[model samples]
Target: MYVVFFYQGLATHLSAKKSALEQLDGYRLRLRKSEEEFHHKEDERHVVAETLKKANAENSVKTAVESDGEEEDEEDADAGSEEDGSRGYTPSPTPAKSRAGSHVSPT
Candidate 1:
């Protein structure tokens, strides 16, 4: 748009200035098209990055939930074993783990 006035200021021959203005307009159009393509690709990249982040967050949450559930199950099993031991119930055939140094014979 500036060339609309710039051409008037140029002292060069009218034909030469007109040709130059036309070339400038073509270059401007190509630059604008290139910028549009660049912006579009940037936007696509951003969307993909956001989606990947969301997926990772979801996976992290799910993994934490599963870990907590497994820990609770292990706790329940350990509590049940402790209760049986305290009550002096007969040990299961699999046997309980012996305490450290319990194999020492009394004098």
Candidate 2:
């Protein structure tokens, strides 16, 4: 009778240990899945950040190019006006004035 009771107790203890191991395995699986999900989200965020950075850089370049084109057009317009003014503004030539720092010796 005593041996039988000992065997029965041992069986109960083994069953409890088995169930505990199963529970531990389930928790570990859940933790692994959550970690994988977290890493995946981080990767997605990194991709989004990189894409936005590229877009901003492209926009900045585009704006810079547009401003440069506008500057060129304004310069062209200014040059055209200067040309027109020069066409009507010929002045009479005057004799050269003597400079105080002149070093020319008469030939």
Candidate 3:
């Protein structure tokens, strides 16, 4: 009778250990899945950051080109005005002075 009881107790203890090992395996699988998701998200974030950096660099170059074009236009306008001045083009008088002179009051 004692031998039978000992065998039953041993069986129960082995069964509990097997159940615990299965639970640990389930937890390890979930941990692996979570780690995989985390790595994928990190990779996506890195791609987005790189794309933004490339766009920023392109915009900086575009802005510099536009500024250079504006400077060239301003220089051309200044040169044109200087040419006009050298040709002795007299500026027109203001409308108020012209009207006052046109209406000379007889004193």
Top of the candidates by lDDT: 2
Off by over 4 Å in 3: 86-92, 95-107
Residue 35, model 1: Cα distance from true site in angstroms: 1.0
Which clashing pairs does model 3 show?
Answer: none
Error of 2 at 75 (Å): 1.2
TM-scores for all predictions: 0.65, 0.73, 0.75
lDDT of 1 by residue, 1-107 (tens): 78967866574678787999999999999999999999999999999999999999999999999999999998888788788785435657886787885587788
TM match of model 3 to true structure: 0.75
Local accuracy of candidate 3 as per-residue lDDT tens digits, 43-107: 99999999999999999999999999999998887778788784434678776645545675799
Q: For residues 1-107, what per-residue lDDT tens digits would candidate 2 score against the true structure?
A: 99999999999999999999999999999999999999999999999999999999999999999999999998887787788886434578997977877688998
Q: What lDDT does each candidate get? A: 0.88, 0.93, 0.91
Candidate 1's clash total is 0
Instruction: Give the 10-residue window scoring lowest on summed lDDT in candidate 1.
Output: 83-92
Q: Lowest-lDDT window of 10 residues in candidate 3? A: 95-104
Instruction: Please list the residue runs of candidate 2 whose C-alpha ends up more than 4 Å from where it truly belongs after superposition.
Output: 86-107
Pick by lDDT: 1 or 3, better one: 3
